[model samples]
Target: MTAPPAFPAPHPSPLDLGGRTALVTGAAGGIGRACALRLADAGAKVRAVDRDAGGLEALAEEAHGLAGAVEPHVLDLTDLDAAELAAVGTDVLVNNAGLQLVRPIEEFPPDAFHTVLTVMLEAPFRLIRGALPHMYGQGWGRIVNVSSVHGLRASAYKSAYVAAKHGLEGLSKTAALEGAPHGVTSNCVNPAYVRTPLVERQIADQARTHGIPEERVLSEVLLQDSAVKRLIEPEEVAEAVAYLCGPQASFVTGTSLVLDGGWTAH
Candidate 1:
């Protein structure tokens, strides 16, 4: 049999995001804020959206000193409209807005469950649908969804949060396949317990649930399943998001980048 012909090596892309715009929902705090700052530092204009006007303004102020501009919007992702999103004209979209509720399925309120689903899963779907037109027109775009380790595995008292995150990952994978023809990529970052305000709140909830002291919750609950003893930092998750949005990641899509310090390794 004849040997197969050698394949040609691919050339590197020349697209540096010097003037590109990125829309980051929940950009006022935690991993979202870190991502906005890092993208701005890399020369991408950032449109920071959050329900908290004061927090959004703070992010914009901090980003003003970076290489790119930051535009703050006090918009709630739960009530976002396509027209308003299109007006921002973003080259990249980061769906990071989410809420966590800790309650057994039996005790979970209908309204709260719906609220979590809307913010975590439904809103991301809507944003992706709205953003695709611009991405197709430009023939280049990136979508990064901030999922969680819970997306893959489950625990008690987080039925709504876990379900939404798992759904978000599936949605991202589907979007990636659809966006491939338009040079757009979609992926999710699944981080372990990060020391953000969200996780801090969970600590309290977990302590209450287990009848343990708050100080022992991290060691006994959050870090117990991981090989690493420490909680993840928001900046670490931000780094993963940056990589997914960079030119180097052009071929990486329809995947979940897990930053769990080996939490899921087992």
Candidate 2:
């Protein structure tokens, strides 16, 4: 109900999500942890969702004394119904939880594919579906999907992860188009390989698949196309997420904010 600080100043103002409710998935660590803290710093009540209860507890401790609070919700996204239920009444949604399985398509297990698609794609749809009603009633919402470079570029032995991300990109665009009329915005933040446990696990899987040592995964596989040649830190990705949820990115719907460090440029 109050006007945001006047912009066009020498330095842009920090985001202020005072009195808002934000839900961040995979909030136990990595980019999700960073995003949760960033939003809490902006004064949003952050519902931190992840299956790792201990990690969530640690996150709660770390978030102590922020402008907002962290409420942990331990649930695996595989439960589509519960995932939707957990999203009800949230003003902002950050769909960051995901999994990866590196193997040739022929070798990719059907169950793993289904699990990846369920968590990374279908659950997000459910959360968006549940959150939309409240958001539409309020006439404002922010939906940020944490996609990956695989969404735009394909690589061998990452069939499940790539497929899910590509689908998420499409879903985000569709949400943007539909939400625009109601003042809700949807966008995807596509980052290249990030230094998270997920990516670290991928390193070992990739080594096994490619028959190369784990040490070469970073230089040869992950950062091969990234001109920056470094694994993006989770905080960097979180900063981008914060920008999208801020007043400045209101007009930035139906777009993929590519933080791939020039991977797609090649």
Residue pairs in clash, model 2:
none
Highest lDDT scorer: 2
Q: List model 1 lDDT by residue over 204-261, tens digit each.
A: 7888888888888878888888887776777778778888888789999999999887
How far off is model 1, as Cα RMSD? 9.5
Q: Which candidate number maximizes TM-score?
A: 2
- Give one digit per residue, the lDDT tens place, for model 2 in 52-133: 9999999999999999999999999999999999999999999999988888889889999999999999999999999999
The lDDT per prediction is 0.83, 0.90
Candidate 1, clashing residue pairs? none
Off by over 4 Å in 2: 1-13
Task: Rate residue 133 of model 2 by lDDT.
Answer: 99
